[model samples]
Structure formats: C-alpha cells, structure tokens
Target: MNQVIHTLLNHRSIRKFTDRKLSQEQIHTIVKSAQQASTSSNVMAYSIIGVTDQNLKNELYKVSGHTHVKNNAHMLLFCGDLHRINRLANTEDNQQTIDNNLESTEQLIVATIDAALAAQNAAIAAESMGLGICYIGSLRNDIKRVNELLELPGHVIPLFGLVIGYPDHNPEIKPRLPIDSIYHENKYKPFAEQEQFIEAYDNEMRSYYGNRSSNTKLDTWTDQMIRKFSTPTRMDVTPFVKSKNLNKR
Candidate 1:
C-alpha cells in the first residue's frame, strides 16, 4: 500500500500523550487539511475551537468525563455551527428566513456531517505527522455545560473534541467486523446469518482484551456493546439540541 493508505489503515486512538507541544505551523496545516474536506452544499457549517488555556482545559476535562484532555498538548473542539450562515443571511434576509434554516432537521444533519468529515481529515493529517489523537465524544455527556464553558452562541453545537499531542505509549490496533458482514452487494442485505460471524468476532475481541498491555479485561466485543448500550446514554441530547434552536423540525 501507499504511504497515505498505510497511515489510514494503521490508525489508532492515542490517549496518553507526552508534554511536547504542537508548533504553530503544524496547527495551521491541520486546520487547512480540515478546511479541504467536502461539505454539504459547500456550506462549511463547522467551526473549530483550539483550546490551550489551562483553566479552560481543566473545565473541559470535567465536562468530558475523561482525564486525557488535561494531559494533551492541545484540544480542538469541532462544532456543528449554523450560526455563521445565519449571521451572513441576516445581512440580506429576515429573521424568519434565518430561523427556518436553523430549525430544520436536515440542516442539523448537514452541519453535523460537515463537522465530522472535517474532523476525520484533521485526524488523518495529525497521524501522518506522527502526532497522536483521541476523539473526545464524551463532550456531549454534558452538552449544556460545554456550551457555557465555550460561550457558544445559538445554532452551534459541540459535536466532539480532539486531543492531539506526541504519543507517550503505543497502543495495539483494535479489531473490526468482517468484510462480508459489513459490505453488502448492490442490494441491501439484512440479517443474513450473522451469528457465526459475531461469534468469531467475539472470540477475537476476547483474545485482544486479554492480551492488551493496559486495562486488560476478560470480555468479548458483545459484552462491551451490551454494557455500553444497555443503559440509556446522552438522553438529554435532543432537548439540548432544541434549546440551541437546532433540530426543532
């Protein structure tokens, strides 16, 4: 495989980071890479907040329910932001027109997709530069608090945060589902004897967990999913989104 493809395939989430700081040139290149990602209707409805303030990072550490944020050299918060579009539209449009755009579910989805695509691009750039990254999705665990901390305006939602720094330790690559199980031919296939595939995957995961260097556990992938999804999570997301004047439709 080529160098880019090799980097993509070897991607791993790095939590433990060293004290090495990222240079301004590196940050500029990463942001430029993110801006090059495709966007729905070319709206580019996303904003990245690069945080280095110690106090702000401490607050985010609590909000994310993860301590890694405190150690990372930098944290980038990718937000699904329609506020910029609304502000631009307000220059030549009515309040009703702006509200109509911000309240639709389609617009919300578009902005979210734009932000996620941009984030992935940034991740690839970071990894290629030999920097480590871990996506902090738990930022949504307390969405309102994050908004308050960041002083975000309406029509903007914090989707997730990315922690970037030099790696303190190398981690094993996690396993994924079989190709046939995930990739369907032309037509969509549903529930086509996945028991065997799942069982095999579970065994592979069990072995992986047992052999990993740190936080080793004797559990299968299925067990982890059950523990994760069996309990309702981020239930406040819908209400919080509505409070931000998004997804009301």
Candidate 2:
C-alpha cells in the first residue's frame, strides 16, 4: 500500500498512554498544523484550551467519564468559539453585528465543521509523529460544568476534548464498512448493504472486547449500540448547553 493509505488504514483509537509528557514545542507544532486546515468561509470559528493544570484536568476528568484524563498525557478542550467574532466586532460606540447564537440552524454547522476539521487535522499530525490521540466527546457529559471550569464566555462552547500521548499498548484496527456502503458514485443513495455490514462488524467487536471478559461475554457491536443508545446516562447536557446560551437549534 502507499504510505499515506497505509497510515490511514492502520488507524486505531488509543486510550491508554505512557507517563511521558508532550513537549511544549510538539504542542505548538500540532496546533499550527490544525490551524492550517481549511475553514468554512475563511471564518476560523474554533478555539482550543490546553489544560495543563492538574486541578482543572481533574474537574474535566470527572465530566469526561474520568477515564481518558487519568490515562492520557495531554487533554485539549476544543470549542466552537463564536465569541471572538462578536467581541471583536463590537466597539465602544457601536453595536455588535455578528451572529453569535449557535442556536441558529444555519450558523451552527459552520462552527461545528470548523472545529471538527481542526481537531481531525491535529489527530493526523499526532499520529504521523508517533503520538496517539483519542477524542473524548464525553466532555459534553456536563456542558455547564465544563464551561464553568473553563470560564468559557457566552457564544463559546466546548465541542470535545482530545487526549494525546505516546501509546502504551497497540489495539487492533477497528473494521470499517465496505467502501461501497459509504462512498457515493455521483449522488447519495440509502446504501442497501447496511444490515449485512453491521452484522459482520458485530462479530468483529465481539472478538475485540471479548479478551477482557471473565463471565458473560461482551455484546456484539450492534447489541452494544442498542444498549448504549437506549440508555440516558448523560441527560444533563441539553439543558446545560442551553444555559450556556448555545441553544444548538
């Protein structure tokens, strides 16, 4: 395989890490690489907070299932920061004309796409440099708590957290559906092979998670998804986000 394809095909989500810390120079390089990714309408609407403080990390760790924070070397809180535009566009003698409400259907996607692009870019850069990274969307487990802990202003909200470090263990590559199931020729179709693909993937995850079982075996991936999607453990996020004035309409 070509080296680039090789790199992509080998991708795995790494959660455990060695105790080694990422150097300040490495952090800067990764962030610079992320900034270089294309942004929507030239509006760089995202921001990142590097939390080096153990106290803050602990607080956020609780919000993020307290798993990745305790296991990873660095945790970065990426955000959809529409506040910068509003703050900068406002003047002492004038009003702010910027649309800061992410609640709006139209504006929300721009910030989300911008943030996701930046985060993915960071992930690719880290992987190429022999660093392992995992995204912790569970940070949204308590959005208000996260906002308060980060002192995030209105119009700025946490999208997720990225944990990076030297991987301590190698995990198997999580299988993906066939290319035809995902890729479109010219127009999008409701790909017909989803059920078959998902069933095969179930067997894959069953083997993936079976290694740690001592009693009942782990559910197949699809069964696990049904259970996960049926549960409501993180129910506080919607109200919390609305309280932060995000209103994600």
- Best prediction by TM-score: 1
Worst ten in a row by lDDT for model 1: 87-96
Kindly give the number of clashing pairs for every candidate. 0, 0
Q: Which candidate is the best by lDDT?
A: 1
Candidate 2: residue pairs that collide: none
The TM-score, computed over Cα atoms with residue i paired to residue i, of candidate 1 is: 0.96
Any runs in candidate 1 off by more than 4 Å, and if so which?
90-94
Model 1 per-residue lDDT tens digits across residues 1-249: 999999999999999998899999999999999999999989999999999898999999998778888889888999999998877755445777888878999999999999999999999999999999999999998999999999999999999999999999999999897666777789765765666778889999999999998989899978889999999999999999999899998
lDDT of 2 at 31: 94
Position 207, candidate 2: lDDT: 75
Which residue runs does candidate 2 get wrong by more than 4 Å? 90-97, 100-103, 191-193, 211-216, 247-249
* lDDT string, candidate 2, 74-183, tens digits: 87789987777666755644433354444565566677889999998888888888999888898887888888888988778888998999998887666665565667
lDDT of 2: 0.78
